[model samples]
Target: MIEEFVREKILNTYAKRTTKSKELWEAARKVIPGGAGSGFRYYEPYPIFLKRGSGSRVWDVDGNEYLDYCMSFGALIAGHAHPKIVEAVKEQLEKGSMYGIPHEKTAEYVKELLRRFTAMDMFRLTNSGTEGTMHALRLARAHTGKDKIVKIEGCYHGAHDYLLVSVFPPLSKAGPRWAPTLYVHGEGIPLLTVKNTLVAPYNDVEAMETLFRKHEGEIAALIMEPVPMNMGLVLPKQGYLKDIRKLTEEYNILLIFDEVKTGIRIAPGGACEYYGVDPDIVVLGKAIAGGFSAGAFGGKEDIFSNIYPLGHAVHAGTYNANPVAVTAGLTCLKHVMTTHAQSQMNDLGEDLASGVKAAVEDTGFEAQVPHIGPSGTVYFTDVEVVDYRTASTYDKKKNWEFWFSLLNHGVLTPPGLLEGGEQWLVSAAHQKETIEKALVITESALREIK
Candidate 1:
């Protein structure tokens, strides 16, 4: 019944991809657990298989066009097929892929990153954020000699068991808002993993303080997204970030900022620059390596000393900073810093925030259009989404109407309205006209809901 109102006429993108996707889905079902690569991208009517993407738009196999807000789930800050990145990758591919032997370019890459992030020092790269976070956790445990780790509810770090728990767990079964049940997000997480992680509400320094004291020596690190952008752009209150930093330091707890989404996309220095909160260990992925797969964990010499090739930390991946990925990452990084490109993107993001706010208000709907730099997310409910519990209270029905309506109107966003709100990403490639076009689509979608 709910699906009826959520879906309007057949999405042209879906219609065009139907034949190809049906063939692919049938073949994929026999091997892949899900027909899609990621669970979040799968839609009820099936997902559109992309053929190619331009600056800010993507075309499916059926040749249907969409103004992609997904942006490869916050990866392509340069947009797909960015010329500089393309050239870099092509040049690197001509040289070779991987040697497992470190190259001079690796040091150059590290130096550029060091110049920008400032928080990163002495680091290693991985194939994905999951591997990077997994290794980072291991290092934290090794450094502190502690088994327990503190994480914020509603914030997703990666697919690893340690961080996967308490991600969008059912509130009926969840414990208090201050104290949440350590429920694993999926099937295979061990009982011990849930027991080890202490879930704290995001932005609530009091809850974090209580947990730190309660756990005492057991807690190794307290990691969180600096801006808490997962719950559709929930910003930190004034003094909240500074307080978190102070408390973590006071408790002898290592502060880790999971900047996987906000890394290079938000600014040259990532969210650390955007908010001015420095963390002990900062993890990055997605846009950090252009559109390629890569993740990195870097920190001060003290903490990084616990890792391998330096100390005892064992972190290795087959494709860690392969030449192609390194080239892509370097290209993206340079693009973000060159010509003050982030300033351009941030300005566009401000315009996007204003447009979304005006569109929502024009429809007389209570919503929050939270944004930071080039990243923005739309929330359907008016309730202040401070933590996981409050984040779950969003209006799903209306969100789906807005989501599907936007999709039908030629914009592509992540599906699963029940999971969370639509994450909006505008690239440097997204021009003023593109943003205005998105505003037109978004405004129409909101009017449909009213």
Candidate 2:
């Protein structure tokens, strides 16, 4: 009955407000494989084709406006089509978009990044987070001369084969809580790739230590998201990160912090600074380019000295440091994303989390909102989600109803909770009034769900 009611509401609302989006999806499917550019963009029934976005709002093809909390999967920390980013891109457009040659803005941007993230002594740019993690892994392997790598279960580094294992494995196939089997996330990933990559439970230091000892000298590095955003923003329990740092050092293994999601959004220095633990290498992306396509891997001088043209671990890309992206990034870092702005966003996020929790309690729903900085996840379960296994146990059906309810009520969230739980992002443009309105909508949605 609940599913029926939710489906009816969604279908009716979608039909009334997204007729043009439906037509666009039909046309898009003729050319685009899934009627969308990315797999995650597609949802059941159809996705509402976006027309434009500005500040904290977006309009669909059929002219339906929504308070966008997805925020391009937490990439647009400065919010959609921010004026500073727009002006920077416009200025760069007159000069050039891409210059297969080195540009001064690239140097300036790197300097700015280094200034913000003091732990990184040297860095290199990539077109995407995948490239950054790929290069970081290669550098780690080259530096340690080890073939194996350990990654926390449920942490998504990217779509690369090396990090794809055990991302969202079924519990039946997933081994033990402590020792998880390296189950490949998708097909076409070779068995050999799975063999070289090891899995460790998130927030489990003893399990990590055991795994490290088991792998011994063969392991190259242990890469992880310090905050584990992919698993619905799971935080590092008290000493989890510190323990991991100590274990890596004791085992003579390198530590790589995949800050692709947390970087620049959580803090200027990212989780490294927020948690006060610096890894040997860090991979960053998303807001780093001010909503443009960009990624970067940086670390101590000794570690980066092993990269191409310096020590031989080749990392090459044609569009690594495009002028437009560099300009936008520089502008965002220098003018827009100041310490004050970040603090404001963090406070807004906390407020939203508290509001959602209150709504859930008032509505008498079995849910929990776990948040950090400007990002959070709504777990439709009573249990606390500390790791992937707990995250997976969430009531996905109820969660979907909650998501559709929000959509029907003119709020935009991720369509589905992939490996991670249902995530919501708060941007700098999200004001107190906007948050209050969203809370009202959330309470209404929770009431309907109940």
lDDT of 2 by residue, 78-137 (tens): 899999899889988998888999888888899988987888898899988999999999
lDDT of 1 by residue, 1-450 (tens): 445546444344345445776677778767876688887766666666788998999987666689988888888888879888888788888889888887877767777678778867776888898887888899888899998898888888888888998777889877898877777887987887667888988878888899899988888898888877666766788889889999989999999988888887677888787778889898888878888998888888988888876789788877887888888888788754464677888888889889989999898998867777877777777787666777777777777777777776788876643345447888878889989999998899888667
- Candidate 1 off by > 4 Å: 1-23, 336-339, 417-422
Off by over 4 Å in 2: 1-6, 417-422
**TM of each candidate vs. truth:** 0.95, 0.97
What TM-score number comes out for model 1? 0.95
lDDT of each: 0.80, 0.86
Strongest candidate by TM-score? 2
Candidate 2 Cα deviation (angstroms), residue 213: 0.7
Q: How far is candidate 2 from the true structure (C-alpha RMSD, Å)?
A: 1.7
